[model samples]
Target: MTDDTLEDFYDAIQDLGHPVLTAEELARALDCSQEEADRRLSELAGVGLVGRRDVERDPVVWYPKEWDQQARRERVVTFPNRREFVVSHPEQFTRARLSTFAHLIDTNGSGDALYRIREEDVWGAPYDDLADLLLALRRVTGERHESLEEWITRQWKRARQFVLRTHEDGYTVLEADSESLMGNVARQVLGEDQLHAPISDTESWVREGSEGEIKRLLYDEGYPVRDARDLDTGDPLEIELSLELREYQREWVERFTKQKAGVLVGPPGSGKTVAGMGAMAAVGGETLVLVPSRELAAQWRESLLESTSLSAAEIGEYHGGKKEIRPVTIATYQTAGMERHRRLFDERRWGLIIYDEAHHIPSPVFRRSADLQSKHRLGLSATPVRESDDEVEIFTLIGPPIGTDWSALFEAGYVMEPDVEIRYVPWRNEAAESEYASAVGHERRQVAASNPAKLDEIRRLLEAHAGEKTLIFVDWIDQGEAYAEDLEIPFLSGQTRYAKRERLLSEFRHGTREVLLVSRVGDEGIDLPAATVAIVASGLGGSRRQGSQRAGRTMRPVGGAQVYMLATRGTEEEEFVRDQLRHLQRKGVNVIEADAETA
Candidate 1:
């Protein structure tokens, strides 16, 4: 009757070949209630002594650890038949690979990799000829890109749902590549024979917004991959400011806990970057924050320094001429995506990586940054929706996207609502209209969008919204210059020096200049929240993504924020705006028609 003898009871049950016992059976034997037996048995299992097995007839079968260990040895040592014998005990496969596998046959323990395959029939063939044999046997299984050794390793891992760490057993294990696992999937979806193309044409289809398509391909192929990631108690992220997350941001953060990597799709000024900072702190590991431009890289460093406990020494910028790596580093996608930069940072283990403006991630260069090892990743984007199907690669390379619509954020009082206006502009040269109508392709669209008449329209709006900051999005550098010179405002293009670009944007953000004209360079990464009024006088090859990105530039929650698009009445420029307006409408941006009376 002494309670001190429970360890003896546990040890006695753990004897090999002992019958499986229930709490009720054990309670009857020990003269105790089933609940008391259950509690004590749980303690034994917690200490790695007692274990459970669900037999065909029994819902829950409790057995000693010895029984579980013996059953596992049976799986590793035995096979379904002589056919699958080549899969595990491949000693007969003279050319077959030895993967510390021979060492696994005798035992199964904490560090051992478990394989559970239930095939009715397996191919018994030589290692070199196994593919053909398997093709004949399974009819569904093919050596699309994997060898017999790898296929068995991967398939067994899928059925077992356990990953094993590598050791110095002196057994060489060949690692698999993306082209092998994903190549077949890509070919099936795109109908393209060459899944891995030349560098010049590598990204023919795997462009942005392809996440959904990639998911379909994975499901169709029955790849059995369930996002090879899991989250745990991350390192405690310490910051200077105490915080309370909004309901939606909390939802995203909680989801991140479920999926170690995911995208947070809140609008600009909805604290997406702040949410990123929160994630960095939550994981409490060395963090890498990737952004699209050097300006964003600098802004991230500044924000962290101001809000987090990270000092200037702790937060480093790896962009442009400055390349510093620290506990918290912010690098431009272009800088970190390069092979040289990758070589420098790839070896370091990052606990968390935050991608700001994550829509840019599917690009060939940006995807390279994903090669670095990181346990947790948070991709932040207003819209992962892109004009190209290439974005299908984002899900595989990063993780699945979790999007909280900008419209929802707007409704929740998290981001500013847009005041959209559709305006019409006459041709800068009326005679050019005849040629533009006759012209085809990108040339005609450019001429129609770059109307010099739009400069006067910008002037009138500047006069109306006198004190409000204005951003004029021209189609090209020369047009931006002509308008900036005529209106006595600043102008920016890709040609602007990095230092000068920074200075010009600083002046605009701080009100040193109320109005500045910039070409497409302003669309992607530059944040001009002070500019409540944006005039879109040019376009980016009818790309709806470019249009939405341009609208996002003025999304910094400034009062009276308005976005106005001016298109030539009858040209393709009008069609482009109409197309972009439809895309924005789907994103819940309000579009209104404007005329002289309204102006």
Candidate 2:
């Protein structure tokens, strides 16, 4: 295969949406002979533009030992088209586009002008020229916008009439109509034609072309673009193009890059994963990201590959299902524990270690993380503390918590702020309540918490939120199984097989299965952005950390969400609810309760 054919093969795979293609398929697509296709595929693979996997011996295949299966040697091939493009054109795009307008204003005008422009205006710029200039200015000096024209208009209108009276006996009144001056500026400068004309044509073209390009880019990159917005300054903003790093995320990354290790705490959907990815990018080294579950590990791997120039081969997964190790590895915490425990310090030098869902780090994992002598460590989680105060070990071993308040994220609209409604469902009979009370011990409490009575409430909640993706959190496996059986929906627990769990999670993510009953395993790391409702059927004792983590399972900032915490009135469950709120207090989460009717 010539170099041109190899390049054509890569481009063809990309244009075809990066589908996995065999040599014959590639040959047919490229209108070449099978032998030519094979040669080009080999050459492409040599340059790392494509990946090849032997399919004949795939353990996933049925009748793997069959004679026919042995006779038919096949290879599954995939092209890293997106990664190649990004690697070849890193200067063309960035995860975080610099604020060109703010930069220019700061460089050319007073710092006050930069401050005067609202974040909306700064982010909403429609002209590329303006955006580029602003970004350039910001690159030279740090500045940000705080207010927009609408804010200025409102302030001007409010200050339109000013009364003044002379101190003398005869009062001289003076009144100035600020509205007229503001109106003139509004008409002459801020008018629709004036403010928008500069970018009207260019913005329209960008809107039309960039959308298709972004969609194609994201699809070729193997991820979905959730939403994209165009700034008024003509800069197109694509969330899929880059993860938005929160202020705390930026600070944590900066600090962690300097220190050996540190913990990051924020509520769920507060951008922990975004921060971790950004930190990895900032470090510019071979980073390893460890999540808590296989599903989460895959999700993170996909997200990183899609959002950055990183290749599938560059990102590795070491979980129950996947056994691959690359420079940028993403593995389940459990799997990571096995690898770290098996290897000596001298075996590998991990430039950076990123722990997602850091709060779930078990005692052994905490010890292992502490023992690692990586150059940098970043612990990420919406909830960083365990129910037990033993979290001090994590802090001491991992590092300090460099985090911001969770409410701020809600205020910033970075995450959904739940309107929690507590419904006190009374026990059907005193006998049931007595039985529940009898099971007050630690182990029994979990079983009692998921009693049959709570199942009825869960059914009602599911019925009420039908058609919407809801995550039901139960305390015990039996309860999850019962719920799954009764509702005929997928259930996930510790006993779930790795491949089945991945399938179930994929269905849930794609809106195929709208409701899922899960054990405590769903409390961390997994990304269920489509889930907008959560039913806390049962919970462990008053561990607010658990409650918050469970709540965060559905707190992804997307569509509106409603969270319900069903508790049996006048029972231990009620006390557990109260205790959980107290735990959230430490993380600066304010639990506002409303009536059941409101729920």
Candidate 3:
């Protein structure tokens, strides 16, 4: 137990020239019982100072630390503690990083600075051919090699990779490194047998959402587990609200305060900003608000200054033209993902991250923003559903959604009453019809989506709704500009200057402009609470989501809402309305065949 005793034992062992000792023999030599000698051996081995053999009985020989090298070279080694090490020292490790997408592991001894293995190189091919390929690769790279499987297995372990699986639905098994609590839960809950071996040994498992839930439970039960990945606990959000929260908004803030993660989905104009700010106040630390666009970022800055006690001085903007990082920063998802902004995010200590229109963060470029460290992450969106990679990322990066719908908010008098209509206009233009029939795929869909026949319906809808502040969504910018020009109304598109778009939106909101033409840019996160009627003149190609988002423009609590979706029948345009508008129909939207109204 004493350092002197261990030193004497080491000297005696080497002096004996055959230091291996049975418990009884060692006990007699040390003038003690066999138990005492065994205890000494156990204590020495505990710190990796010795190795023991002959387990069946007490007659065991203890070897010094010199044998470890031999053991490693001759054994199937596994690093069970790799997960802990990687998490604590993420900087030191690289998961098979290359120019392309990174795999979780690199073949350590694969000689080349970049060690890569493709599926085509290793899988479903002849074993001889695979071996030859690996041998050749190793020879060229000058890496000492072994059996192909062994080399790959070594890389796999180093990668610390695992897949999270679900049984009921077809969800892609996310290939992630088990360097955080997220990864650990997937591995531990999926299969105990697989966990016992090197993680590479159990490359796949059948799991469910409940497995992820268990990790949350473990955290609640006081298990020492990390809840987030690569996040800094930013400044405590100093929440100063200018207005009081409604009952439901208060409930949302409460839930987020407790969990410190997850999404809040409420109908548009349901005061999600207030709820998010309330969460910030609850956390009371430095914060970063990420939005889908520069406009949304400005909107967040304005709302923060207007509603909360936080001043413009405290709030910073990270966007296309402006790059200021203060205690509370507002940034576009695009800007936040850029290399410089990413460094700023990583360098700063952030307590809270609130995503306005959180669904956007799940996109390919935007998802990288999730890698920014934060103590709390909150995503706000009316509909958080996505048909892309972000769908899964939303669940993992933030948490599940805590939401209320249009009807729920409507019942509470928090949102405007909605009037939904589908205006199916006949495709009467033979020339356009011929062009569409002759075209295929995206070209055909584009032709159908921007059909000239929809122009007549647009005119009729403007006539019918003539005076109400109106927002018209067009499928293409050229069409939007033409419609704006024809009607003498301003058009807003991606090319519209920020100041001009803001002025146009202001004029529309204040009744100076009766009608405004807009491209797809207005489909998300832009607030036009005053507009009661929206004419969806044309929509993105077959995207129900785009249609749904455009409809969201006016569904907020302002009363007397009428939404018109213009669709050209007997073409791919009709399919866009049908496929994209199905969910709206299911939600009690009064979809009518409105050729009569047009006539």
Candidate 4:
């Protein structure tokens, strides 16, 4: 049989939605004689491609050996126009191949996978050329898709059309593939703010302090700039990791070293910080780490001391509480971008700058930190999404996303996949309903989010979980305090003092405090202990990143991680909660919904 016949056989099975076929059925499918179909089946069986089985009182049947057992359990479906694929029970090979040119968006415990192809995915494909990416795509999808392939090829070319290079006079210049692109796209989009003057028809002298803006603007216009300018490596400071890196972490470090900038995106326990340290070790230069809060700044200092061959004196904390500039310093975004404190960072050259919780980098106030010049930039975030949908700026200003598939980590037992469920609780009384209904705008949402009946539901869940380590997340501080008082647990919020916050977090880590009421502050920044159960009693309105971060608090190597999202039923809160967890569902988390009374 020719290869076309073999491919037809597989296609027939998919069209039939089964694995087995008799000689008569095969003959009809192949448009050949029954005896010829039987001959082809025998030939395929001899080659171990198909298997033949005889029933007691029926004709012998033929089936592809590979699909005989997995026909119902494993399958791949594609949507070319949407550039998305869904795979059920995907094998390791399928995932590994897809990872080359696709981004894993969702998965579940049963190994159901959802992946989408984006321009960035194609631009940053880990291959030498388009042929390798196309081969991988064909292998994963079982065939080539002309439209999708054409789009990917165009994106691959766009990724290489623009380059930022260092001019001989020690200035940055933007180079385009053609004069038309430089003049029509780069110059018109960049204006005089980012471009000083045109050196050549295809080259423009870049303004001294507008590199980030230029990259961001070009990227918004569907062109990602390759930053290849000669940059300072800062003061030479020997650094080495005291611990070993996992295989994936080593790969991430290698990719960052080659690209010189990227965001390390992974689940909470996938060791992104460790990988950042690995990149620092690879770069071997002075470092600056920017975090979202003072607590995270302190945590970075501790992580560096524990994982790297660095002494306390060599590492500094430059937050509000402490101000010291050492070989390696950790500062909060607010302080680092301040006009007065900005000069402190400007005077010193940094070999590498690591942005912790980098999703904050795209905001107006925080974006100034992205302007800081460094030879290499590394960003760390569990979820790089934002409410404004400006997450593209995160990649444009920092670098492309680089990480392993979440399902792979879950399957390897490196991180536990949480069982997420959303429970809808009803109002406790008509008065409560009346108050919520009478409210207006934000007040309406606040009333719905703080429904009184949730307290009873929370108590019931606590009783069910018993002594397991748990966390209760709330959006409002008052609600958090109320929950804390009723449950007799400490409420950890932004209002909590630094000393008390540290003590509470330390107690939780050591199991002294089994349960704590956490506010928005715990959504990111401070490292909360891994718990067996996580409950979101109230959450910020429909933020996907917040939902993921809250669920990630329970994701660790240990099993039995459960996450419960509570929303006020018969109100807008239901929609908000659903929208919040939509991202997790796309990532393959099975989100079950139920009424509070039944749950």
Q: Each candidate: what lDDT?
A: 0.62, 0.56, 0.63, 0.87
How does candidate 1 score on lDDT? 0.62
- Which run of 10 residues does model 4 get worst, by summed lDDT? 66-75
Model 1 segments more than 4 A misplaced: 1-224, 227-244, 595-599
Residue by residue across 134-238, what tens digits does model 4's lDDT show? 888888888889999999999999999999999999999999999999989988898889888999999999998899999888888999898888999999888
Better of 1 and 3 by TM-score: 1
Model 2 Cα lDDT, one tens digit per residue, 327-395 = 776766665556553363225566677877677654665344444435566787665556565664454
Candidate 2 total steric clashes: 19
RMSD of each: 21.3, 25.4, 27.0, 6.7
Misplaced by over 4 Å in model 4 are 1-68, 72-82, 105-110, 138-147
**Mind giving the per-residue lDDT tens digits that candidate 1 earns over 1-599?**
22443554664456433667777667776678888877777787777777876678756667667766564341223233321322221221211121111211121112222222222012111122444444433322222324444555444443222111122442211112344443344344543332223222112222222333433354345442233333222344455545666666665676675567777755567778777777776667788888988888878877787777877888888988688988778898889878777876776667888888887877777876765546787888766666786554554456555545455455456677777788877666657777787788887887777666776787788899898888888877877887877888778999899889999999998988888888888887777767788889887355777777777666764465889989877776666787886656655567887553222
By lDDT, the candidates rank as 4, 3, 1, 2
For all predicted structures, in order, the TM-scores are 0.63, 0.56, 0.62, 0.87
Give me the displacement of residue 444 in model 2, in angstroms.
5.5
Off by over 4 Å in 2: 1-248, 258-260, 338-341, 360-362, 437-447, 585-599
- Index of the highest-lDDT prediction: 4
> Which residues of candidate 3, in runs, are more than 4 Å off?
1-232, 540-542, 586-588, 596-599
Q: Residue 257's C-alpha lDDT in candidate 4?
A: 91
lDDT of 1 at 307: 72
